[model samples]
Target: MTGNRTHLLLYAVEDLRKPLIQQLLAYPQINYSFADTPSELLFQIAQQPPLLIFCRTTERSRVPTSTPLIILCPTHEYHPAQFIHEPAIVDIVAETDLMRLPFIVLRELREEHAIVRETHRLRTLVEHTPYGVIEVEIDSRQIRWSNKAMHHLFGYSAGEMQNLHIEDLHPNDIHTTIINAFQQMSSGDETPLIHITCLHQDRSTFFAILHRAELTGTGKRSSSSFLPMLLVNTKVSAPCKSMPTGSNSPCARLIKDCTISISAVVGQL
Candidate 1:
């Protein structure tokens, strides 16, 4: 989805910078857009931010919040800190180092493009997969992420399911068993596929195969404190009738519990 536009922006004079423009054109990664005047440059900055910028420093110019700005100026006349302090300008180069512009721009943009690409890939997988996939906080079991299948399966809209919990959908009779299962999963045990009855948003119950894996701190949560895991549940059959209170039916035996790890689901992401 992100490959529709070019990545580079330059604000400079067209006629005088012929030699410099040729050097920039040599790199195939560069998708260059030009803005000759201060007003045009400012408009581009506000409307379409680029990976990198090469322009003459003017009183009207303000660097973008994140895009790397490389000012064109005489080395001796430049005050490096003034532009660097703006929180956007990344470098300043004199005319002598014009050859380095493309390399520096490509290096600056590589990481940004990779992150965008990966995020798009993951979003596509989650939305298209048949199972109801969710990521919940290990300690709270609060739902952090849920795909379309999850919301549809539980009879909740995307907005309604935000900040909801797994317990919110579990039948009250199975609460104690589910809690114990979560405790075991959090302690680092691999849980097998367990069949269970879960409550929908309308208070109806359905049978689903729940799979759990313990995700350590990495990928989505790159902190020591936040250990969120994946929960993948596939609806195996139609909605089942809720059994009478304290009845030992065939459904009771199917009510096992589950948990998961974020790093383990990289392919899913």
Candidate 2:
């Protein structure tokens, strides 16, 4: 569980002179980082961002998405969400409600804790499952984690998958499409259906369907993970040969029979 009174990043020019800055710093619930200019604030934002921020409406353009901004402007004329490109914002204290900032901070802390707890629970559920699971980072298409079954399906040992990127495991054209789908899944887009071919230790390939969704982690940081249920139906319907070919090697004949069985099953899908 995370601390309810976690620090929030804020950017202000000559922050020491701002009256609200002193109060915000003193308040245990809100901890802010003060920057002198938009450029400085952006630099700090790339390094560390707060869950919620306090800044003037004119400074809205400077806020980062990681730190959802709360405008400290006098007028409630603009919805802070619109003026700023941040995903969400809670306009608790405008200039008119200066006195109420402390109370709102306390309330926001409690509500924020609840949201964090729920997200943790969901991630726990996904992580604890017996099914082979993987969280693929969208931008880089890297394998974040792999479950027990996934470890078995691929020859890679426990920590070995971490060394391999998704594109390296999956072949060419499918790599780009899968990476894009994973990103969309994280952004609340429709769940991506992936039919990925995983290579086994002996260099044999097997297919599995990937169920993907965006996991909203702590502080709204997002990553894409999936539950892959291995489909093992190779034995039941192998290709039947009325007449056996004498010329082919035993290994060649066996592989040919397995391929035919896989084709029939895929046709049913």
lDDT for each residue of candidate 2 in 33-91, tens digit (9 for 90 to 100): 56677777777666755566667767766665556556676555644555444455666
Residue pairs clashing, model 2: 9-50
Residue-level lDDT tens digits of model 1 in 1-269:
13535466777645436776688767766777778776787788778676677776762265555666777767667677776556666677776667877777777788776777776776565555555766657678667777787887888877777657666767899877766676665565445324567888888777765545323222443333223333445445554445431224433233222222223344454
Output the lDDT of residue 225, model 1. Answer: 25
What TM-score does each of the candidates earn? 0.51, 0.59
Overall local distance difference test of candidate 1: 0.62
Task: Please give the distance, in angstroms, between residue 86's alpha carbon in candidate 2 and its true position after superposition.
Answer: 6.8
C-alpha lDDT values of all predictions? 0.62, 0.54
Candidate 2 wrong stretches, greater than 4 Å: 1-6, 13-26, 75-88, 167-197, 204-207, 213-269
Model 1, residue 251: distance off in Å is: 23
